[model samples]
Target: MQDKPVLKVVNLRKQYGSGCDHCDDGHEVTWEKNSCPECGTVYACNDVSFELYPGEILGVVGESGSGKSTMMKCLYFDNEVTSGEAYISSYNNGETNVFEESSQQLRHIRNTILGMIYQNPVLGLKMDFSSIGNIAEKMIAAGNRNVEYMENRSKALLKHVHIPISRIKDEPRKFSGGMQQRVQIAKALSNEPPILLLDEVTTGLDLSVQASVLDLIKTIRQELGISMIVVSHDLAVIRMLADRTIVMLDGKIIEQGLTDQILENPQHEYTQQLVYSLI
Candidate 1:
């Protein structure tokens, strides 16, 4: 039997601004219509949906403004959802729609269940704090009060991400860009979350650095059996990390399939162009 998905999302929508003439009529608004011709309204995400199974890596690929990041933000509770349901099997027995949860509950979920690595290291790491402190913060938030345990966990995770344990007390600002990213990865995994959300983790890095980070992610997945949703505009990143892929256009999923199938034989016109452009 196929393994049940660890996370499920349905008809997820996030919009900015009040109802417009088009929205008033209950007509579907395309992403291209950012500002309604009749009345201004921004549609950042509309009718997005997907599932992520345990130990599976789902790649969300699209150019800028395609709402890939917006969707992830909603999932991470960094942005609020306008409508739709998101369920995590490990949370509340998957009965509660995460979007409807109270802020406190959401905070608990974000702290304990979901791990996120931002494209910008500054956003993910506390530059003022030592690398160990950054990781310890997550552990502390999860109710882990044992100082020794937190320190050991942080050191082990740092080592796992290829950061030297000797630098445990060093500030993130002192690290290289790639190393800072590695530190963020270690912090995200500190709680041993069942799901990890990686947003353009390889962007703005040297080619060699990108490869090393990707290799680290692959190793983590193989060793820990973690489920991940990797978001990127770079097809190469998606191809390297994802088992299955979803192509988004104008805030909507236009195509989805196995990574190799989507890369080798794209079905949608936009996907075909995206694949060919990378060749």
Candidate 2:
């Protein structure tokens, strides 16, 4: 492990409504789950925090409405945090808080630093654009303008994701679900980012396709050595892809540990149910 983390998040919180004294920080009033029954304030993510080491895949597994996706979105700058700070080792020597950057700086960070692969292909891919075009588009966003270089680079990325050369010019909308995801993966890697955030990347794929995509993810991490944070509800997916895992419930991290350790010796009741259900 490196002495410094590539990404670190501290006390991250995302809420949907203005809170009363009951749901404010350090308030004693509590609710059954994510929402404050009295105030109707939903804590989509509540004081969640974690770190991603260089070349490591950190998995976050949680059921729907568990705040895993919200956290990923916050990290990707898709959603603003209610309060907290995040530091990237490559950006400002990890001294600057990402949540506080300007909109222009945030765009620069998205283009050159962090890559996001959304659960929905529609969210990540330009379905009407050619697969290669989609990849090239990301590079262009990152300020690459040489036509020849972009074409070659796009081809290489699509090839890396196992997209056939014949279909390089085909639009993502015309491709099958699995192929669309492969193209999305290629697009996310177009900028050669140091950190990639995968939000439920395999949720809708067939079992066989899911396995292949999972294999490609593992191969990409090993070959590129890029750090990643994978969010999923599937413990099986996390087990296959993550070096370390965190279990989230009700907008909080209830447990986290090595993937194997969590699988073999889960501590929290929710985590235990999740692991045993795999059997």
Candidate 3:
């Protein structure tokens, strides 16, 4: 039998500003209509939905402003959803929609059940804090109080991400961009979360650095069996990491299937253009 999905999202919507006159007429918002010409409402994400199965890597790919990151932000609770339901099977017996949970419950979920690595390391890491300290922050949030335990956990995670133990005391700002990203990964995995959300993790890195990060991600998934939602505009990155893929456009999922299937036989016009452009 198929395993139950670890996470499920239904009819998710996130919009900026009140509904406008044009939107009231049943006009769907496209990327070009981000700001409604009639009433100036911005549709950052509209009726987006997907599921993440246990130990599966789900890739979300789209151009900038396609609402890929917005969808992730909503999942991570960085952006509040206007309407919809998100259920994580491991949380509260999977009966509660996280969007409707209290702030304290959301905080608990973010700390213990979910781990996220932002596209910008600066957003995810404390640049001035020692690498170990950064990892310790997550541990502490997860209720770890023993100094020795926190230290060991941090060191082990750093080593797992291939950061040398000797460099554990150095601040993130002292490390290279790629190394900082690695440190972020270590911190994200410090608590052994069941689900990981990675948004444009390789966006601005050098080609070589991107490859290394991708390899590290693969290793983490293989070794830890963590389910991940990887968001990126680069099809190559998605191709490298995801087993299944979802194609988003103008705040909606336009196509989705096995990664190879979508790449080989794109059915949507937008997906066809996206795949062809990668050539």
- For each candidate in turn, the TM-score is 0.96, 0.98, 0.96
lDDT of 3 by residue, 1-279 (tens): 147899999999898888866674666645254566667777788888888998999999999999999998899898889999999999987889999999898888988999999998998999999999999999898888999999998998999888988899999999988999999999999888999999999988999999999999999999999999999999999999999999998788999999999999999999999999999
Please, what are the lDDT tens digits per residue for candidate 1 over residues 121-234? 998899999999999999999899999999889889988888886788999999999999999999999999999999999999999999999999999999999999999999
Report the C-alpha lDDT of model 2 over 1-279, residue by residue, as the tens digit: 898999999999999999887778557765869999888989999999889999999999999999999999999999999999999999999999999999999999998999898899999988899999998888898899999999999999999989999999999999988888889888888888999999999998999999999999999999999999999999999999999999999999999999999999999999999999999
Candidate 1 regions off by >4 Å?
24-35
Question: Lowest summed-lDDT stretch of 10 residues in model 1?
Answer: 29-38
Query: Model 2: how far is 236 from its true place, Å?
Result: 0.6
Off by over 4 Å in 3: 24-31
Ten contiguous residues minimizing lDDT sum, candidate 3: 24-33
What is the lDDT of every predicted structure here?
0.91, 0.93, 0.91
Off by over 4 Å in 2: none
